[model samples]
Target chain A: MNIRVADDLTHAVGCIDVTHVSISLGEEAEAFEAVSDLSFAVTPGEFVCILGPSGCGKSTLLGAVAGHLKIGGGQLTVDGKPVLGPSPDRGIVFQQHTLFPWKRVRDNVAFGPKMRGVGKQERRRAADQILQLVGLSGFEHFYPSQLSGGMQQRVEIARVLINRPRVLLMDEPFGALDAQTRNMMQEVLLDIWTEIPTTTVFVTHDIDEALFLADRIVVMSARPGRIVEDLRLPFARPRVSDLVTDVEFVRLKRHVRGLLRQPEKAPQLARLDPLGVQEA
Target chain B: MKVIRCLIRGCSVLSCVALWQLASSLHANLGVITFRNVPPPTEVVESALALLKSPKLLAHVGSSLWRVFAGYGAAAVAGVAFGFAIGRSRAAGDLLLPPLELLRPIPAVAWIPLSILIFPSSELSMIFITFIGALFPIILNTIHGVANVDRRLVASARSLGGTSTAILFEVVLPAAAPSIVTGLAIGMGTSWFCLVTAEMISGQFGIGYYTWEAYTLQNYADIIVGMLIIGVLGMGSSWLLTTFGQALMPWRRAVETR
Candidate 1:
């Protein structure tokens, strides 16, 4: 995989753009091509969902944008600047709860800023604010082990948001939770997203989840993963908790499911480029 | 309920004493030879009481304690630093491990003669033996801890903008702590055992010195008493180490309770 930006392509105003991205894992036997020739632009404060079968590098794409993974081919530039490494501008929320067992909820949230050289006094204040935003106001001194699974995930989000990242990369963040708690977490995430309108890339396998949370859903395919479809979610902005019962949300879920079912044993998914290239 | 438990324990101790007396009476000649012919438990207790009152016991205990603290302390610090390096870096682990594995199997007490030859002072030699007793276990445990730390933790930290050094200190150390602490506890016990063996080298210090001196004099009662003292001190020190170590590990009992 190789990435080169044509010197003439002008930057879109206030959006994170990917110019012909191709991601590969390694030379190991049966080493699948993860993400292939995928490109999309996330506008400022855009909530985009990359939905696919498990292990198709949806998280890898997020990792690339977050500067955690090296881009084999593609430039993920935020605000006309290349992502160097994980800067405070790109905070990632992990699928499994990554709260450090040693630290209390408050200190865990305070970690990124503390690492980024924020003053102790100010970082603590910001941590408190983020904790409050994530609905963990009273759990400041509580350790991760003391909290339930749902609460632990909340701490994970609060920890990332404390840094005030411009792009929030979430990799199946609520996949481990029970259905009831997952839905509750979805609602909490929406509330948190509302307060700080960071452009979010949420990667998940759940069709209902993609519809519930995303502004645009990019359905991905197996193995040499490429965008199969980019379904623009018609659900209105500030997605409410009640949207689960919305008729359009059900239609959207069925529509995404139909697309997913078509590619189960298919030879390859036709690559999608919403800008110009209509078909193979 | 606590009193009843204590009373039961107390009764068990009394029963043990009674059995000892009963055995000694039945085999009077052998019982006399057991404490090297110093009569029985009654006579040994008298000698132990007399020795307890003497200031010599303090000097012996103090010197031994001092040697262990110096040696074990140095070993723990060095072991942890080097262990983290070996654990985190594949290059370093490969470079260092073969020699360490070779050196580790040689008993720490086996170093006493070589340590004496290498260090100018016997005092330093004893400390060196103690350090050897501890250093290997601590380093090996620490290395295993760091190397085998949860992969997700490293990835998660990387995703959160953590540098290699930051992840090593923050995530790796904390994750490997329980294993490292177990190594340290084992290392301390071994160090103490080596300390006693090392001080028996005609040095006029430590429990081993007193123990050897008692054997030469053949004051059988004192010899028995000395052995008992060493056992109790070793047990006491280990207990302290484990108790202190447990305070750092809140997760241990938490899992059991869970």
Candidate 2:
């Protein structure tokens, strides 16, 4: 895959325009294409969820967008600039809480600004503010190991948000938490997003989570992942947990599940036995 | 439970001492055992008390400590530095590790002859032996630690716009610290062993020298005192190393407690 930016193409003002992006992994001579011609656009302040079954390469796609992984083909641009490598302009949260185990919660949150050469006093204050925003007000001096899994995730979220990134890429940030904790984290995420909305591309395997959190759900096909459907969710903001019982939520879940259940779309998935990609 | 555990430990130590003292007394009276050289706890204590008054005891301790710290401190810094290079860089590992691996299996005691020839003084040779003993474990553990750092953590740091230097300082070093500390603790034990061995074989001063002198003089009680000093010192240094390691990593302590 190759990326070529033509002179005539205009930047979409404030958006993540992923144009036929593909990613390949493994050796040079026999590289396996994991994602293929996945095209989509995320408008400014839009919350988009990329949902797929395991081995679908949704995380790879997100990794490419975050500039953590190199795109093998096509162009991926954020607000017009091509994503060649990682920048503070885009922040990512992983399934595992990636806060530095050595750092205190406040220091972990302050890391991005610290890297960008922010002064000690200023970064600490900014970190405290973000920590408070993530509802971890009293956990400033606590190390990651002392906190529960849910609290660690909160620290991870605060770490990313403190950067004030234009695009927030989350690969199942709450996936490792318990069911109850996952629910609480989702609400907390929504509250934070409402307060300071950024263009978000959240990748997950959970259909209910996708439906609940996304402005648009981008469902991907299996191996050699491509876009299967891009359904717009019309759920109003300030959505409550009670909305899960709404008929529309269940209908959307069933539709996405049906799309995921089709085995014919990716026959190569069967060959991946014992080596299944951990999507969530 | 804690008090009971401590009491059990105290009793275990006392029992061993009591058994040794009884055997010594019985052997002295009946001549049942051929182990005449074995000093009783009383004799050892008396010898230790007598030795404590001699100024040479302080000199021996001071010299041994100086050599051990000089050699071990140098080894620790050099080992960690080389370990990071070999672990993180393929070129460095390929170029340097094979030779190190070949040299590592050779025991520190075996290097005494060559070290004596290479260095100007036996003092340096003794320190060299201690250095060799400490270096291998520290380097090997550090290499393992740095190489095994979680890829996800590095990736996350890179995504957060971390430079290579920043990532190394902030993520890789800290993540590898637990393993490095384990190596350091192991290295400290090995350092003491090699130091004593080297001192016994060829040394003008040290605890090992004092012990060797006592053996030549047929002062079995003084020999026992020397042995006990070495044992206590070895145990104490290792404990200090572990405590230092724990202080550096607050997260590991929390997890351990949990």
On DockQ, the leading prediction is 2
Candidate 1 docking band = acceptable
Could you tell me the TM-score of candidate 1?
0.88
> Candidate 1 has which clashing residue pairs, if any?
none
The DockQ score of candidate 1 comes to: 0.33
TM-score of each: 0.88, 0.92
lDDT of 1 by residue, B146-211 (tens): 888877666667656676778877888889998899889889889988988898883677888888
Q: Candidate 2 i-RMS (Å)?
A: 4.3
Task: Report the lDDT tens digits of candidate 2 across residue range A1-280.
Answer: 0112342335322389989888876577966887888888889878999898766888878778777678878999988889888777788888878888889899999988888888999999999998989899999988888899999988998888787787888888888889999999999999999887777889898998999999999998778777889999989989999989999999988889998886465454422211113322
lDDT tens digits, residue span B10-94, model 2: 9999999998898776665444555456888999999999989999889999999999999999999999999999999999999
Predictions in order: lDDT: 0.79, 0.86
User: DockQ values for all predictions?
Assistant: 0.33, 0.55
